[model samples]
Target: MPLDTGQVDTGQVDIGQVDIGPLDTGPADLDLEEGNGVLNRDPLQSHASIGEALRAVRQDRGLTLDELAERTRVRRSYLEALEAMRLDALPSRPFTIGYIRAYALALGLDPEAAVERFKADEPVLDEPLRAPIGVPDERDPRVAAFIAGAVVIVVAIVLWNVAQRAMNASAPPPPKASEAQAWKLLAETRSGPVTLGPPLPAPVESTIPPLYETPGLAEAGPDGKGNDSAPANINDLSDAPLLDLTTLPATFTPKGKVYDSGNPQLGSLVTLQALNNAALIIRGTSGSVYFARQLAAGEAYKVPQLPGLTIDVSEPSDFQVFVAGQSKGVLPARQVLASKLAG
Candidate 1:
């Protein structure tokens, strides 16, 4: 459109109205798979009754309570309870079946027999424990005197063994003060070495031991393997062998019941002595100390880098402690370091 020069225009116009409603913008429309309405199930096997098992095995072998107890090291009272189906009378389940199975095996019965019996239904234990008859029960009041006498005998024997062991562990037989005084008087009277009864006779060929010898030079193939036919004439030397005393510890526990020095400590290092008059020392690894009781007499134990720490025992049946190759002292059933260890 053409506009004339110097023309001006001014005007205002109105707009139309609009309406708005609420809208759903939140997350939706999720389809979940429902689980099955019914679930699966299973059953367990019933355990064997303790009483039934004990009774069956005992009756099968015809063993009485006393005999069973002696064999299994279980008390007669416990075995009596197990047979009566009185599970509660026994201590714990582990202890109960353990003793029961041991008793069963002593009777040459099957272990499963015990398992079956352990799970069987049991009767209420309203009555006191009873022993199987015809065992000549030593616990009987009638034989109380005899049993007491027998026990005393056993105790005496045990004490005697302990006393003997104590004596052995002590120093070699010592001379009394009176004997020393007599020796002094005798020494004053003596001037020189006394002649032996008589000179020994020359050894006969039969009495002489034959010398050992090897044959002529062996042929070698440079591989270091020599022919046995000719083993090279090597001469043998004879002389008193030198002992490695440094390795022998002066303290030890002998292998005897007189005193079972406890086993070596676990994780402790130990040396296994060559049984024939041999001595060895080893550091305590955790396990070495647990087996110390297993060491025999004539064996030596030494601690590496610690000479004063040692144990020496002789007569595999007796316990003795020697320190620095000399006797420190003797310990009966238990040994403790009585004297101070030289630094």
Candidate 2:
């Protein structure tokens, strides 16, 4: 071989150094171990059930159900149900499908394919449609009876009201009040003087004395006349004056210009007469408008003597106030509170 080195082509070969270009620095191809080395089976091979396929992949990856549960964050019991294909033991279909997807991902298998296989194995049950039951048009006898009773009660109430009205209509009117009673009522309503009846005669003083003061009975008078201050007959009241009805002053001078009329029904008729053209507004204390108008000369408006009523006059002097037929001269003020005039 040493003698042939000189005869061989030196240009094509190197004696001590050879150029093989840069060595391949990329990662070398690695032959991954398919299954548990002993069986050398494909973990992702097609199986009759998704559960079997998942179980095989799990075993190939050397993972127990407890480990797979930890990896997938699924319950061990649920994983067991999935591996055993116990659809009843698993959760709802959607939840079971989620578990399957998680299990496939943990075992390095396709999640969608696993889900498809799970669906094919356990088809979802369709609920049978039910026909609606018909309701009868006939009403309950108890309800009808209740309605009839209600109607009867309403009719009875109406009839009772009619009968009460009829009874009231047939009843006689109340008796009229006597003159004395009328006077008493007027006195109660008005602050004015009321003449009840004519004045009675004065009482007569007896000139006789009591029988106990007789000279023979007990003590004697200076003239020896027995109690001349006492009446001769105790029962003789003929000399006594008649009992006077309750008396009142002959006249009532009101603090204000207005005075109450003796008649209660008519009240105090307050007449507002326009001496000249004037604008006036008659209202209540609560601001309810009773009258608002421009009066012509000599026009008159009878103001109701209702309490709390008031009058506003544009020209106080133009309007003349008359209460209970007595003239009060003119409007007391531009805005007159009628209650101030009430006696």
Candidate 3:
């Protein structure tokens, strides 16, 4: 039913027809345009970065990082890392993703959307390749056997060294040999005596008359008398001719200041005596060095009667050679080659 009211003049009132009908209950009209609708809001577009969005949402919810950590069961440091976008400060990718999801859930946000935003904001890193860790199989008997063998070998080596040291420590040292014994030993080890050439010719006798047999010397006396049985004047003997040393026997006398290699001999005992301190080397033709040392003054070395042996002296003038105890005099040169001394 409709009720019609007649016009009534009032300052701010006007009468009108009123119709009573069913009550209208419906949704209020809303502007559903591109940027004006609540359902069409872009969550990521509200902040400059994912970290800023997370911080803004947490701040809007009146929640501190400590409260968020308690709600999400994460450390406050990790929550601060997320809000600060310090991905390196957080854990690994998967663990960080879990932390982000938990944080978003505590802030009443979409966990998956937050994780996606976190992933988008995260920079790609070229992580180094790591070798996969292998778990050893303890059931293999060969491995245990190898380990035992290595241990046994190490222990055996240690014990062997210790035993060697102990034996060396307890063992008596060898007795020292005298110088004469050492020479005897050296002589015994050398080669046998060499065969020498034929013996040298006997010395020629001088035809000159003897000094005592001189005619005037035999008859003259101390009284200047021609007596047959008196001592002669000592001055009268000076008139006799001097004996020629060149005519002496080759056996007992020295050859000269130079050795005659023409007739090399391995005498009964050929010795080398140092007139002064000097170095000496006695080497054989076979390249065998029998003696090499500094010979003190007056020190002697018995030559090994070996054929084809040569002598070397640091100073030829400081050495003397002897054959059968008679000095033959100094060497001809510093080096007496095999042809010089052993021919």
Candidate 4:
């Protein structure tokens, strides 16, 4: 301390402006002042750029990220990114530098030294961010598969919905059992002209009272209880089996021939066998006898042995008599009048 003799005391020296031993300016004291100045320097401190620092002095201490985190309370990820030099992964430039300062302090180094060193070499970046690293191009396989799967699922759902709507929209009201025959005909007509047998214009699923036999048969009730009774009207008599096509006079009219076999191998002449139940007896010109017996509705008939004189089966109403491959006329059951067999 600087002292004047007039103001000096022996035990405690006093001075008007005495030097307290040159203001306590030892190395330790000077270091303390310098450290305090660094701590309070500036609010907006500068930071280094990415990859600017080739090496870190604090890292030489051999402290691990976990070890340093224990000391500074910074997260392990931040400490790792800092040491890894993965600057882009960090929060911000100022924050990264600040973290580095704390890390240096935790490592028993001067915190300001780390900051100053980083500030000296600013990192330089030349490009803006676009695609991420390790990602594929526009036609990547994984991306395409994902998109395709999504599209397929969407289409399947749409098709299912369409099918459900169609089924619901086309639903018809239920009908009485008595009207089933008429309704069935109408329904079949929607598909196309239904042929019971080829050459027969209409398929006869319903019992067809023959054109001539219609005048000879009786009109039974809806249940057909009186089908055997005598003719109730002129039309009823036409249903009786009064004539075979062979017994008819040549003056009567007939139409149609087998235009095509539909199958060339079978040709136009198709023969069906009479089962235990048959319709009529067919005797060929070659002395072959075939029994055509109780004919069922929609049932077919064929001469088993007559390969060339086969019967082209159709609805009874569709039966046209083709003699020697020429059509005489269509056979309306019970009305057997032979006209020209050539159509």
The lDDT values for all models are: 0.48, 0.68, 0.66, 0.48
Kindly list the per-residue Cα lDDT of model 2 for residues 1-343, writing each as its tens digit.
4555456554754243322323343222333343322222233334557788788777867889999899999999999988889977876678999999999888777788778767777787797854444656676789989999999999999999999999999999999989999999888889767779888888768878765643474455333465656533322223322322133112222322332223467555677777678888878778988788888766676676787787788876676666665665566556766655444
TM-score of 2: 0.27
What are the runs in model 2 whose C-alpha is more than 4 Å off? 1-45, 129-343
- Point out where model 3 deviates above 4 Å: 1-40, 129-343
TM-score of each model, in listed order: 0.20, 0.27, 0.28, 0.24
Q: Write the per-residue lDDT of candidate 1 for residues 1-343, one digit (tens) a residue.
A: 8876785565554232322222323222333334422221110011134555456556656877787788889888888887675665778667876876786677665666555445444334477766654577456675888889999999999999999999898959875678889898899879677777878898786866777544432355333466445332221111112334454445444433222223433222222233444222222333244223444444444333322333333332133334444543232212222122222
How far off is residue 87 in model 2, in Å?
0.7
Per-residue lDDT value at 53 in model 1:
47
Model 3: per-residue Cα lDDT over 61-152, one tens digit each? 79888888888999998878877888768777899889878877887788898788777677666989655456564598898899999999
In order of TM-score, best first, we have 3, 2, 4, 1
Which ten contiguous residues of candidate 2 have the minimum total lDDT? Answer: 243-252
Candidate 2 C-alpha RMSD relative to the actual structure: 32.3
Clash list (residue pairs), candidate 3? none
Per-candidate clashes come to: 39, 9, 0, 37
**Global CA lDDT of candidate 1, please?**
0.48
Best of the candidates, lDDT = 2
Worst 10-residue stretch by lDDT in candidate 3?
A: 254-263
What's the distance in Å from true for residue 286, model 2?
44
Candidate 2: residue pairs that collide: 207-228, 208-227, 208-228, 208-229, 208-230, 209-227, 209-228, 209-229, 209-230
